[model samples]
Every structure is written in C-alpha cells, then in structure tokens.
Target: MKQTSFTEDQLTDALRALKADTSDERFRLLTSEPPKARIRPLLWYGVAASVAMLIVAASIWQSSWSIHPDTTPTATTATVDENLSQLVGQSIAAQTQAQQQRTLTNDIVSEHLSLVEP
Candidate 1:
C-alpha cells in the first residue's frame, strides 16, 4: 500500500527541485480609504450653550436700556446739565484760542520767509 504521509526524502526532493509556475500579470497596488468621522454631540452642545448665552446677554442689555428716559428732571440731572454746558463753553474757548495761535504762527512764518527772500 502506498504511504499517505510524505517521507523526509520526498520533502527534501520537493524543496530542492523548483516547481514551474508563471504569473505574468503585474502586481496591483491597493490603497484603503480613510474612515469617515462621525459628528460629536459635544460640538452641538457648545454651539447651543453659546447661542443661549448670547440670547441671555441681549435680553439683559435690552431690559436695562430705555429709549425714553423719565421726563421729571431731578436735582442730580440739573447739576449734570450745568456741568455739560460749562464743558461746552470751555471747549469753545480753547478752540478759539488755538485758532488765534495758529494765525499768529502763520503770520510769523510768512514774515520770516519774506525777509529771507529779499
């Protein structure tokens, strides 16, 4: 009966003698695509939190501000008005002084230039 198992001599002969085989087809290089990222809930939560904060801030600011203030002028408002008027008067005086100084400087420069030319 022929032996079903391979002997040491048969294995050695198979290993030493090269079996004929041909693969003329060039090797095909394959690249696997990267896995798509899943949307996280944390990002949406952050956006919602920011929107909520903005809404709250806007509501607070709107509630605090008034377009039409109380018409009843108190003593403090009277003083503030007086102070504003004084500030306006002082600024006007300073502007006039600055204009006069500028005119004087220009006159001096023109006189100097005229003397240098002669």
Candidate 2:
C-alpha cells in the first residue's frame, strides 16, 4: 500500500483552514445561541486598563522628578583641582619609570646579543 505522509506544517495549515471555514459558517448561522464574546465588557476592560496604565506612568514620572538630591558636583572645586593636579603628577612619574625600565631592558638585550654573536 502506497501510504502518503504529510509534514507537520502541512497538517497544521490544513487544520487551520478547516477551523476558519467552520468558524465562518458558525458566525453566519443566525441562531438564538448566546454570543461568544460581548463587546461592551471588552471595551470597558480596555478603558480601565488604559486609565490604570496612565495613572501608573504619571506616578512613576512624578516620583522620579521629586526629591532629587543634587547628586552631581558633590566635590568642591578646590578638591577637584587638587585631585587633578595630583593625577597629573602621578602620570608623569609613571611615564618616567616606564622609560627607565625600557632603557634598562634594551641595554640588557643588546649585551646578550653581542655575546651571542661573538
């Protein structure tokens, strides 16, 4: 028997099409059946949700701006200038130390090369 196998996507698409056709017929059928969903309750739910979200957003914004303790420039200008000068001095010292270390290493490498060549 030559059995035909369908892929998952093909089966899902077939089921989806069937469901759509049946739903369309059901909606078109004019019977005394209760409605599936009421529009008025859903509309009210959406309005209530929108109002709650607006209130929450407004409170968040107002709270964020309120009681802002001047967090910036906590350090005085005198201390900042002192710290800047100190940093500059430390940077200069570090460069001088690095140059001296490089000079020493170069001299040692050249001495080793000379011995190796001879």
Task: Report the C-alpha lDDT of model 2 over 7-103, residue by residue, as the tens digit.
Answer: 7887787777774445656766845445545777788899999999999999987776565656233567788799999999999999999999999
Ten residues in sequence with the least summed lDDT for candidate 1: 25-34
- Residue-level lDDT of model 1, residues 25-105, one tens digit each, is 322212333233234566778899999999999997766554435533344767879989999999999999999999999
Candidate 2 global CA lDDT score: 0.80
- Clash count for candidate 2 is 0
| lDDT at 81, model 2 | 90
Off by over 4 Å in 2: 1-73
Highest TM-score model number: 2
Candidate 1 is scored at a TM of 0.37
lDDT of 1 at 104: 100
Q: What's the CA error at residue 109 for candidate 2, in Å?
A: 0.3
Rate residue 15 of model 1 by lDDT.
Answer: 81
